[model samples]
Target: MSDTQNMLNDFRWIMDVVQNIDVGLVLLDKNFNIQMWNSFMQNHSATLAEEAIGQLLFNLFPEIDEQWFRRKTQSVYILKNSAFTTWEQRPYLFRFENYRPITGKAEFMYQNSTFIPIQGLNGEIGSICIIIYDVTEQAINNLELEKANNQLEIISKTDGLTGLLNRKSWENLLETEFQREAR
Candidate 1:
């Protein structure tokens, strides 16, 4: 094949991978207009790429706090550095429904997203690419573990039969009171 054919084939492969990847990829211009929306986004949001492209990001997903998003992206544009947000910081940008069977307990999908600055040919930041990873399973598991730990702590401190403080707990409380009084 010719060199042009090889380059064309490489481009096709790259596009295929981007579209089929499990994570959501959204490319937006400086004005926050959607430029690219991959298949993962389409599946979760039920919004086709054709419909999403050229639309304002805030308009399509009104749930997204426009002010908050602008603040987050501003730094990326100015510094040309990547920014990250974990599920703990903010649950999700798009309120996508949780459809995975294992994470059914979660009502909405938890996301860890990255804001990447895309530089143009002139070496100026022109667009931002947001990558969204579904982290529902990890978030739910952490929440459940926390709940279990709280229950275990309560059980250890309280009497099983009477639902009152155990001897050890009472003794610790007495010691704390004594120390405070001494002070």
Candidate 2:
């Protein structure tokens, strides 16, 4: 092949690497149609790459939470920074497996997802990439920590009979929310 042809071939191969990566990788055009859906995502979702590629996401997965998608996509367009979502926030968006193929348990599941906006070289907006990573164990640990904190809060501020916040925690949380809303 000529040098120019070889360079084009190399570019194709590099693009293939990004798609074949072992994560839930998806690319969406600026209009939010699916541009690429990797093998890992296809396998987990029981969808064919051909069927998903170039399809509008809302049409393909009608079950998707529209409000959630709206907020994240809005962030991509308005803020231009990656947005992350932990498994606890919305586990139904993507399936997560926390176990190794050979030795791990099947029931364990968790994931973190990120949405990244893509900009073209000409300073024009182009596309976005959505990536997901398993984080089930970490989510569980965080939940445990939260439960402990809840118990501590109860003990630190409680009216023995009425089971209220002993006037202190109640004042704090109410004031905090009130101040935030005022801003």
Candidate 3:
């Protein structure tokens, strides 16, 4: 293949989609330094793939907690699964929905992020692939939308005004909260 086409094929996978995805993808070394940052990542993170390559995790964005660094490094090097704090735990780490204050632009919103270990030629993990899928429009906005009657047990006997246990819910709530506080 020609150099131009080869370079294009290196990341032509994005062209398959009709309406471009807000999602971003990044390939990171075991140390968590960026190895590959797709166009989406560049547009969203406000940093180009070429510019951020070879930098350390701590140096990329200080908002990323030390705990995340320790866990990510361990997972890439040792083949372990690590969870990320998205909306609830650590909102700043994702930085998808909002733009960098310095740049003043929001790229995209990704609700889910997964880190996978990439194996080297020796079959040992040599890097980590960070795949970020933008699901904000589906997850946050459509949360209550998919709610089905079958999902929740219908409380025919409950009071309509409060949607609370006429008596059963009150008992359960009181019992659970009291027990929690007691402990």
Candidate 4:
């Protein structure tokens, strides 16, 4: 096969892989227009590739915090680097339902997203690529663990028989009140 034909085959293979990945992939121009939407994004967002392409991201998902999202992508465009977000900070970028059987405890899927600059052929920043990871399981597990620990702390601070604060806990509270009164 000629070199050009071989390159086309490689490109097709890569595109196929990207379109089928579990993580939601979105490529948006500097103007926030959608350039590419992978199958994962289409499935979760309930939007078709053709319909999503060319539409502004914020227009399609008005629930998004426009100011915060603009700041996130703007940093990538200005620095030509990547930015990261956590589920704790922003929950989910797209309001997709948490369909994972293991993490169905949450009403919506928790996501951690990365914003990366896409370089153009001219070596300038052209667009931003967002990669979304489903982190609902981790978030749910962490929340459960935190609740358990809080319960344990409360149990430790109370007297079992009297249902009153234990000696140490009472002393700590008294000290705090005393300090406040002195102030």
Judged by lDDT, which candidate is best? 1
Question: Could you tell me which residue pairs clash in candidate 3?
Answer: none
Candidate No. with top TM-score: 1
What global local distance difference test value does model 2 have? 0.78
Residue 62 of model 3: what lDDT? 78
lDDT score of residue 132 within candidate 2: 76
lDDT of 4 by residue, 1-183 (tens): 999999999999999999999999999998899999999999988999999999999999998888989988888988888999999998999999867676279999899999999899999999999999999889989999999999999899999898888998989999999999999
Ranking by TM-score: 1, 4, 2, 3
Candidate-wise lDDT, in order: 0.96, 0.78, 0.63, 0.93
| lDDT tens digits by residue: candidate 2, 1-183 | 899999999999997887778778888887669988888788777788899988988888776676778877888877788888877766546644444676444355566788898887976557888887766557777877898999887888998898877878889899999999999
lDDT of 4: 0.93
Model 1: residues with Cα > 4 Å off, grouped in runs: 101-103
TM-score for candidate 3, residues paired by index = 0.57
In order, how many clashes per candidate? 0, 1, 0, 0
Stretches of candidate 4 off by over 4 Å are 101-103, 160-162, 167-183
**Candidate number with the higher lDDT (1 or 3):** 1
Per-residue CA lDDT of candidate 1, range 23-99, in tens? 99999999999999999999999999999999999999999999999999999999999999999989998999878
Could you give the candidate ranking by lDDT, starting with the highest?
1, 4, 2, 3
Comparing 3 with 4 on TM-score, the higher-scoring candidate is 4
| Candidate 3 weakest lDDT stretch, 10 residues | 83-92
Candidate 4 residue-wise lDDT at 87: 96
Model 2 off-target regions past 4 Å?
Answer: 95-109, 140-183
Flag the better candidate by TM-score, 1 or 3. Answer: 1
